[model samples]
Target: MSYVNQSQTLNVTSEQKYQGLLEKVLLSTLIAMPCCVFLFINGTMLFTLRSKSVFRGTSRYILLYNLLFSDTVLLALSQFLYTLAASKIMLSYPVCGVFTMLSILTDEISPLTLVVMSLERYVAVCYPLRHATIITIRNTGVAIIVVWAFSVLNVFIRVVLLLDFPFSDLESLQMTDVCSDIDMILSPMSDIYDKAYTGFVFLSAGVAVISSYIGVMIAARSASTDKASARKARNTLLLHLVQLGLSLSSTINNPLLLAISKTVSRVVFARMQNFLYVCFFILPRCLSSLIYGLRDQTIRPILVYYLCCRLTLSPQPKLRPKIHGVN
Candidate 1:
């Protein structure tokens, strides 16, 4: 009877392990489907932006391209890192640093680019006569350059703060926990700086977007302003606020997940985390694509054409070439 009980206990343990594995696989699949869909949509949107001379030359479109490009890069890297964590793959500090740094670099670009785009829209709506001169192609290029330089500067600061950690004392560089940005916060200053920098960037960006929204609203009242243009710009700025909120929320998800875990069972926490990852990370990256592709009259049909790849559902018509009989 003792031996029989031991066998039974072993069977139960094996079953539990199998169940846990199955749950993780299911969650990963659920998360991956939406992420892949969003990635595809974002890719299609990027291609659509570059496919036309008009899109390439337009300042807003140029800013849109930069925004979508960074968002897509961050989304892909985030998904990859999520998968690694889901599979319990623990990476070495140096290795994880490479991954995290790339992720951070791209992650920072979206919010800044949105701020630039907001200003472009503001000028278009509030100062219509000067829009062409102020938002020239060269000016847009300079804005993009400045945005990237600023993001890189932030990364450099993080690296400098990271140097404060003593790497020589460790027995091994392999991380004790799953590779994540939180895990890489080896020193108090790193964490403090990260929080401080993130807070400041988001605060500044939020104020800028809100200010643009107000500017657009005030302009809407003027007799010189085009009512339709002002209305559209107002709505666009509102959506910019939403995008900024989503981006800001993503930066705080780790703490939110930790709080959530304290109140829920392990199983429940895992499920909630997977759901939140999709909402916070994957979905926001694709909003630029959706917002511009569907909302803009110029891009809606063209975006549809590229997304479908002429799969009979494309908006663009197919042409058949006629051949005269050689005989």
Candidate 2:
């Protein structure tokens, strides 16, 4: 009877594993398709932006480049993870460490870039005369390099700590792509350190984004020359504010949801966690194509032109040649 009971338990466990695998495969497939499409779209946006005279030498152009680069990298990463899921490529410890390190670094770096962009906009709108003196291309490039270096250095600390983990766990040998064993990695941190670090990153990033937008809003309302300019600035400020809000809320909410899903045996919390992750990660990537790429005039024309050429039997329209005015 004891042997029979043990065999039945093993069967049940195997069934659960199979079900989880199926669920993960389905989710990854759903995530990968949209990300792949957007990756191409963002690529075109980047290309079009580079080829245009309107975007050249502007801070917006630099931001467009960074946004496209970040999104492309992120989309490629998502596709890679999904491919791994499809193949069920269980990674080794070294591969897992590298994957986790890159993911964390990139993830942190993107927000830092956004924060820098917000500050750029703030200075440009709020202090127009001072902006020319303060926020030059050289300074912007330096700031961007600093942000990348800092994020890399910070995330590298986490990577080093992960390497020095004293635990004797078999799970490290068969790591998943999602950075699954965060709790294990956090073991060395005192309660105070963990809380402090989390709060600092989350709060500091949020504050920087918000404050920049607020500065923009005030400057737009107070110093703008025309109603249209003011309105445009207001819209831009609000959009950034909304993006910051969603990102901050999602950042705080995801870990809590994940914690609940792990600690609780209820199906309800598990479903909730899945829903929240979809809302947060999946939604943001999907929206980036529309928000950052599709809205640009240069990109819109190129995309429409390409689509028309591909979809229609009609001949392509000739683009007007650039005329150089006499100096």
Candidate 3:
């Protein structure tokens, strides 16, 4: 077999083996109430920021917009799927296929968008002078278009592949309506294609983001020009690093952990894989709100202002003191 053919075969085998695990976990992902809360907060922040001119024109605003859109869409899409499944809604063949396509698209897009945000910050901080020219509003718009276009292009393959394979084969005996036909529908070539595409997305967006922050930190070390500015830059970079680290660890390790749990005979390893996934994906999803809420200067201030405004109104001072004349 040629290299491409071998790669395709390996991916198909892996997909088939992992199909059960992915569906089981993906279905359970909908039960997360935190998803709704996070989406609401992020949506509100995006709206407020965009309403103000300061957020609309800045590069950070562009990144924030993309990030908020990505997460909100993912949560919404997940909830849709989970709700349908939970309510026992039987979807048509085409609808089921579309749901699967969208689920993957949204999930993938969230990480890819984060990658873009990271890269934007990296370029702005590391190449401060050039950032203005490189990350202009027009360019940021194009970059976002590229991210969506890429996701759509890749996800559409599912439709064609599913049409080629009948869903009847993968149906569970226990639940006939819920489709279990992911791998059977995926083209044999899907893995090679996806791996290449996912790798590009990770390196171009994810790695670039990390590298940018690293560059900024290194530059900040030697520049004694303004202590306060340098300190703030370092803190921002550190927070970005933390977010990136969490994301990268999940993207890279989750698959490997699953593969090991499958390939190895030991039951403990499989259990460990479950543990790591919760730590990586679930925990991060729940905690990212708190992380950004506290550490992100842009987001933190808005939240503080919102909270203070809520607390300071004093509720009209409760006027019950004028009844002494009647007594």
Answer with 2 or 3, whichever has the higher TM-score: 2
Q: Which is better, 1 or 3, measured by TM-score?
A: 1
lDDT, candidate 2, at 73: 69
Number of backbone-clashing residue pairs for each candidate, in the order shown: 0, 0, 0
Q: What is the lDDT of residue 244 in candidate 2?
A: 54
Q: Write the per-residue lDDT of candidate 2 for residues 1-327, one digit (tens) a residue.
A: 999999999999999989977876676667666767677666666666677676657766676577556656654664575466457577766665676566556556666676777777777677767988888778878887897898777777676666666546554666554433243354455334435656787778778877876766666666454446556655665666666554444456546875787777765674565566557655665565567555665567665665344465678899878779933
What does candidate 3's lDDT look like per residue over 1-327, in tens digits? 599999999999899759756655564564456566666666666566666676788766676667656656655665565456545566666666666677567556656666666677656556767889998988888878888888887787755655665456865423346442332245666555556766776677556656766766676676643445556666665666666566555555536765776777754674564455456554554454556556666667766566354355446766777776685
Better of 2 and 3 by lDDT: 2
Better of 1 and 3 by lDDT: 1
Judge candidate 3 against the unseen true structure and give its global Cα lDDT, from 0 to 1: 0.62
Q: Any idea what lDDT model 2 has? A: 0.64
Q: What is the C-alpha lDDT of each candidate?
A: 0.90, 0.64, 0.62
RMSD of 3: 11.7
Order of quality (lDDT): 1, 2, 3
Ten-residue stretch with the least lDDT total in model 1 = 310-319
Cα-based lDDT at residue 132, candidate 3: 91
| Residue pairs in clash, model 2 | none
Clashes by residue pair, model 1:
none
lDDT tens string, model 1, 70-136? 9999999999999999989989999999898898899999999889999999999998999999999
